[model samples]
Target: MRLNKVVLMAGCAMAIGLGAVSARACEIKIGATGPMSGAATQWGLAIKGAADFVAAEVREAGGLKVGDETCQLKVVTIDAKYTAEGGAAAANNFVSQGVKFVLGPMGSPEVTGMKPITTRNKILMFSDSYARDAIGKRWPLTFHMGPGPAAWGDPIVKMAKEEFGIRKALTIAPNDQAGTDVAEVVAQVYENNGIPTKLEYYQRGTTNFAPIVTRIMAANPDVVDTVSTPPGDAGIIVKQLRQAGFKGAIGRLGGPGTEEITRIAGGLDVLKDFYWFEPVFIDDNVRALQKRYHELVGVEAPENNFFFLFVAGGRALAEAISNAGTYQDAEAVAQSLRELHVNDPNLGQGKWIGEKTYGIRQELSLPFGMGLIRNGETLPVRRSDAPTDE
Candidate 1:
């Protein structure tokens, strides 16, 4: 009897040791892809920051449930170098590695490349591109993390007309897809409302906008609205407008409208009448997001698309993981994702923005807030959801 009792105690200890080993062995992998270098390096790095921060935050929070075990975050990053072929290859690579969810490149080319592979693998793709072509239409496994340029474009025009007292407008944009989309956004709304529009398009990198400036000056419209890419384009457009003696009203859709823009534009002094929508509004939601973001990244809150949208995206994915606990299946994750609120970044506050359909199938539009540079700061001009004629 003494020998049997000692044997039983040893067996119990061994079982406990094995169980601890099993618990410590589990891991989960998440993926993010972008261009990590070159002219667009800032955009790519911001995305990487959001993805890495979320993975770290989720891991530190004790990980996702997986069948009597828990797993920590294992983030996989692919550098597409901002190319279509590169993006397609990265998507295939992620699938080969058994990762089924991915965040795609922020621009049009990369998102276009990854679509096919994502659909085949049933990977849920979330993008930060401003192309309207991607939305108001559906892709099998693709989703948007924010409003399209078209979504915000028309509304800003209405604001320009009513708030700034302008009807007839002269507009200029680059020939790229994003620029075309922004111009179309304005035209769709303005044409429907019977407002006359004088529109012009240019190649992406033009050193002398003087010809275009001269033409717009000749038109002499009430508002000169412009939407272009990079800090360089906007800075030049605004600067040359003042330089070329075209003194009509100036409206800017500043994508590169970073704090850097005001400085690059020779100071906000030159951007007096420009307006751009804020990806994040100045509400409790944004403040709470900034706080959590600062806590995780050890820097000032990223004020661009990556900061706010990433927090929103991570919360959505985390809720899904928690709800689908103990089941690491892809279907389980996808289904649970639809059920999660994806609320505020504090991860403790603000309910998800949409109704039942938001989490379940898709969102009507990821929420956005509009703002204008007022008194040298981006001030909330109006809520993104403020009543409109839809």
Candidate 2:
């Protein structure tokens, strides 16, 4: 039996039941594995909700058009609990369930553990993790959804140089490979810009940051950069830094979870001297998407990095499948994804950009906004291109 061809006609979808492919639409499942519980639970929840939001939007558009077949997308999410072991188990379960495409296993460590299983199963993967070292030749089937560390670091360096006249930096991050990678990128970017940098590692899950804050004060750097610290930890660091009498600039070198971090730090007041990078402008267009997201999910969208990235990434994937005219062909979808120029409600204007570093045109090119929290609101101070090593 030939598959029915699905097409969008006059702003609606119709499945032509004229072929061996039945008119009855099939469901295409996209699996998401992440830390649904544990320290990173909020990140997991937001990403999952964003994926669902994308699915809901696609469904509202009368289902996804895949060549001649109209398919409905269903997101199947598994909790990885923010650990390598848990991620492996989740990937194994996904493989068993015959899930071909997966949304995320948020952390690089989690991806490292899950990659073997996902690869064995030939699953196409998308993630918000910015660990660039984890992508590239080794992981052929996986793609990094948003800007990585270099993307974050380069813009901050440009902003610091132009606006703050910053010359030195001190970085604090969780003691892990992700942290190490982020610190390395920022340090290199800063050093190349003629700014000396130092890095400090903290054990994950530490709440009282008094000692860390004291050490940071002693360093007396011009900028204190948090390298991929969780929202809660970033809050503590920011608050404690202020309390410890440090009056210098601060930068969130990773994708900053703005809302969550500000809330945890007691409000936007605590983020007064902070600067971070956002992939898109949160103008009226993006705000409308956030409103739609809240209405669909029954929760206010977190103004975090991955919230927008996941929504945009999910939409991009769907578009790729439609353009490739196949829901089951991962490589075709991957190729299509690279060629897309995205201008969605959530993502603004973007194009896939990383050909030199990853050896594939995979990274999304967008003007990253340098944001600052001032007078109780977060606003864009400047906008610049994401770091791409040509």
Candidate 3:
């Protein structure tokens, strides 16, 4: 009886020890705030879904290595409804949850509102906006993941002049901060490239483009460029422009505007002389990833086309945490991020840039691709200059 009692106590102790060891593994939480409802739901869904997918992938691969133990990743997404108030609320919720890393609260208004909350809590936010106002000293903790307005507009204007023989351009946008910023950048680029540019602004949700298109046709510019127009509105513009008999070239200083434009225009045949500053490098490897993603999720990749950045950011954060030897120290993790030279098939090779502009080395400077819609497919035209991390 005594020998049996001893064995039972020993087994209980061993079980408790193993259970404690299992519980020691950390649960890392990543937060994402974006417009998950209303017109911009696609953007939010893409960012959130990509982050969740990457976390799942990491979880499947035996979790993230943090010091001597493995940590699991959990992506917590909140819908901001494309409003500043919504963004602030989401940021507060993340603060309460003790989340240090956040993916996005896209658009100028959403990001602007979320900035104070994120700064107060020392949370690292990755912004997707190309507006210059979104960065700088005010939002020190925030990093711009997407390319700047000039990055896209410069090439598009150059392409318009050299390839399409476009000498005159007219720009239209939503009149919001992002639209205004992008429009200004594109106009400047066009002017510099010897293409005289005119500007027009419209309120958001203005579906009726009859008046707008009529006015654009009156201008009779060689190119009609849409700067930072949302997907739904972009489609409306394209369809209406065709109906209004504007035979000038159509172009986008921002976004590929492929699937949305195609669906709304009824077919690719409607899009004549269209060009875009593509966000993603649509190479063979990225195509493979997109196929696999569709198989797992039952839909095509996000129209935003920068879903790979979230995945890369997640992996980079995990690596940073491991290298820093502490998950709680955000500054150390940020430093690690700056030091990382990321080379992914989806994003291609790039590293942190923008110390001269943003007052910090936070922006990921990667090779920006330019393309045109040819036969219902995006065909690359040129590759922008990017400093390779040697």
Candidate 4:
């Protein structure tokens, strides 16, 4: 009797082990890589939050349907630290784990670092970098999360000129590819709009901007634009600019971080004359998206508005994975993504653009907003249509 009982128990244990293995086999892992530490941590967190929320949504609906099997969606995140080496390391980590899809590596340096690895490993990536070559025909598996300043800079520059009557502008950014690429584009736009502009660069990781502020004040620019500067650094520049009594309109013709900038510079009153590019105009639909995130993910979403953009991208990726019927086959998934209509329930209609600029139509073009603060009073964001080749 004892020998029979031992035999039955051994069989049950083996069956349980097999069941666990089967369960793991059905899990689909997606990676979220970005600068999860330092000044740009907010952007990385937004990417992670979007991935987690999408995974939660899939799990709530009984997992993602791929062919006949319902596969579990899992998000694996790594901190790229806003560096080239960090981004490459993150990609290698994903490759080792058999993760075929990745969400971000938010900076230009990070994107530059990860591109070769992602392409070589056949990992499909959706990056939110403002680099000139962020999306190209060379990396067909990579897609842009949103259009860079090349699309929206002109409109914002025109608005600033009209509102603030700025004649001369000085743009400041870190002395690196990430900063120069965006600053040059924005400076061109300002000049196109009849505003003479000067380009200034500071070494990265410089905490004190008093020297830079002194140079800017010496130039006596009617407006100062912080293009592609991290929010933490930009805030210090703004505070010192104000302290030095250099009262000119301040513009962020780069990524949206008005809230953080405002906080770091003290408050809205300190950002007396400010304008920026808001990736999404918050409305009822956007608010509903945030509420859904809280309900599904059980926490408040990241404060940066970039969260919405990542959410839209994440949903599209999930849909493509389901339609492709195989997450392991990233090429098939990329093809399906290329055919997908850029429509998010919350963000509404968008389209793929960037053919004229990047030689590929892989960039996501969505409605954007121009934010303003004049005389220390905040104004509602004004919406603009998505940019086209025209």
Q: Please provide TM-scores, in order, for all candidate models, with all chains considered together.
A: 0.79, 0.87, 0.88, 0.93
Cα lDDT tens digits for candidate 4, 1-390: 011111111111113643642233467898998989998888899899989988887766666767756666789999998888899899999999999999987899999999999999999999988888998999999999989988888989888999999999999998988899999988999989888999999998999988888899999999999988999889988998999998899999898888899999989889999999988878899878788889999999888888888888988888888888888899999998888887787887889998988999988888888999999999989999887766
Worst 10 residues of 4 by lDDT: 1-10
Q: Rate the local accuracy (lDDT) of all candidates.
A: 0.60, 0.74, 0.72, 0.87
- The candidates, ranked best first by TM-score, are 4, 3, 2, 1
C-alpha RMSD by candidate, in order: 7.6, 4.2, 7.1, 7.3
lDDT of 2 by residue, 1-390 (tens): 011223443343344666443344567888877778765777787678778887777665667778666677788999987667887998888888878778887876778778887777778888766566556766777877766756556656777677666878898988876677777777788888889998998988799999889899999998888867877788888888987888787787676577777777777766676777665655666668778977766777755556676777788788888888887777777888777767765556776655665666666665567777545566665766544555
Error of 2 at 322 (Å): 2.1
- In TM-score terms, candidate 1 sits at 0.79
Q: List, residue by residue over 35-91, the lDDT tens digit for candidate 1.
A: 676435556666666777776565555555544555556778888665667778888
- Candidate 3 versus truth, CA RMSD in Å, comes to 7.1
Regions of candidate 4 where Cα sits further than 4 Å from its true position: 1-25
Residue 3 displacement in candidate 2 (angstroms):
20
Candidate 1, residue 131: lDDT:
58
**1-390 per-residue lDDT for model 3 (tens digits):** 011111111111123643653244467889977888765666777788677766665655556666655667778999877767788989999989989888887777788778898988888888777677767777777887766656556666776677678989999988877688778887888888888999988987787988988898899998888867877788889889988887777888866556777688767778766788766656676667677676655677665665765656665666666676666777777777777767754667776766655566677766666777644455565667543222
lDDT of 2 at 291: 85
Evaluate model 4: give its TM-score.
Answer: 0.93
Cα error, residue 95 of model 4, in Å, equals 0.8
